[model samples]
Target: MRRFIDSEADFIFVLAANVASIQAEQDAIGFDAPDAKYPHKNAEGLCSFAVLVQEKFSDNPILMKMARIVQAADFKDQLDDHPAARGLQLISGGFPIVTSNDHETAERAGFLYDALYASIKDNVGL
Candidate 1:
């Protein structure tokens, strides 16, 4: 999990929650990635997309909430202690996150995504 600085919001909480969800899946089943890949390799594009979505749904409280959650959960410390990370460690038997696909375990990835978006929106006052 990547960490973001420059804010003290609840982004860590949201990230932890999402990570937890994903780790659950990995524990139940398994992950298959031949080579290491950057999950958010296109972060710039993703950020741009997030901005567009926020702009389009500026009046939607639900969207706002999601952004705020994400923003608040973006801290580095949170990523280090995230439940998902722990879960992955247990399931993978000590594999590094870069080689793991534990984040796919979330049953409700959509909900988690929504919450993250809301958290980010709230933090940026968008």
Candidate 2:
């Protein structure tokens, strides 16, 4: 998972320096390398991606909420104390079961994040 995070940071750094640098990639999507050769699940990639999103959208509550889930899921074993994090971890477990193809899984995950963001974006005072 850590390895995935490192690689994602590298990717984000490059993307930030390139196409996504001038304007915020507000439409940025998250992804998990489902079949990574790594020993454990690649939750770290999503975690890293969340970090990028947090940096880009500092005022976005929806993305921030999603980031909490990503952060929690990545560190769930040792640092997850929030109920939302725990629930996200459990829900994410099913993502792998939904599809074996990484691209499809990523697309689905993106949609899930979009829906999550949409669901929370309109609440006045949650």
Candidate 3:
């Protein structure tokens, strides 16, 4: 994934597993969704990382719909939040099995996401 980024990129952002270990950098941003102890503003407490990003760039209805599905699928307690969460479960649960690596899996999943967005746009008139 880092290889896919532009060489001239100004900054990088990542969802850190441990935000405390991240060194201060003017060109990078790190976020964490800790489930346990925290100073404040944890992602798991309010919403999934997907929701946080979607809310920021929510001008597109299709992406917003996908984000809702992601939020439901990601949270154990909110698995029923969206009707399509179960299907997302099946797709994501087995996605890594056939793919060769993290980058490959994510790149292949892009097609599925494209189809989903198109389907939503066509069927839901979004």
Candidate 4:
């Protein structure tokens, strides 16, 4: 089923929540000095995406809520414990404007987002 957020405030909250979730993972796993680079890169990418979404659809609550959900998942730490988790994290992280309730949900959500993104890009001549 397609879940929708309906408001920009909700989207911001989702984004914050997902970011917080990621921070939680960082806290739990304790990355080494060398590993720190990738995490920082990931975070920067997320921030950039969020900025783009905010700029492109300032009034779309669905997009905002999706962002908040991504921020809330805490995928980093979860992945540290399970190999499968890493794939899910990458997928979800790639599309922060989508919401997933749990691991399975995350996978499905990622698939949906991937298809949607692909379709959009294809249709846009990108």
TM per candidate comes to 0.28, 0.54, 0.64, 0.29
lDDT of 2 by residue, 1-126 (tens): 122124353222123234333224543333333332221234443456465655676686766776666676766563454566666667767888988765566657767666666666665355
Question: Candidate 3 at residue 6, lDDT?
Answer: 43
Tens digit per residue, CA lDDT, model 1, 1-126: 112212332221224325445545444211121111212212432222234336566776655454333333333333353334333234334333323343433323434454555555676677
Q: For candidate 4, lDDT tens digit of each residue in 3-113?
A: 333322221112332555544564522121124322322544443334445656667555554444343334354335433335546665665455444445545664765
Which 10-residue span in candidate 2 carries the lowest summed lDDT? 32-41
Over the stretch 1-126, how does candidate 3's per-residue lDDT look in tens digits? 122224444423234554444424342334333431231245444444454445465676766787777677766777888998888777878888998875677678768777777888898886
TM-score, model 4 to reference: 0.29
RMSD of each: 14.1, 10.5, 5.5, 15.5
Compared with the true structure, all predictions reach lDDT values of 0.37, 0.53, 0.60, 0.43
Worst 10 residues of 1 by lDDT: 29-38
Model 2 misplaced regions, further than 4 Å:
1-46, 124-126
In Å, residue 48's CA in model 1 sits off its true spot by 5.6
Kindly give the number of clashing pairs for every candidate.
Answer: 27, 0, 0, 15
For candidate 1, report its TM-score.
0.28
Candidate 1: segments with Cα more than 4 A from true spot: 1-50, 77-108, 114-126
Clashing pairs in 2: none
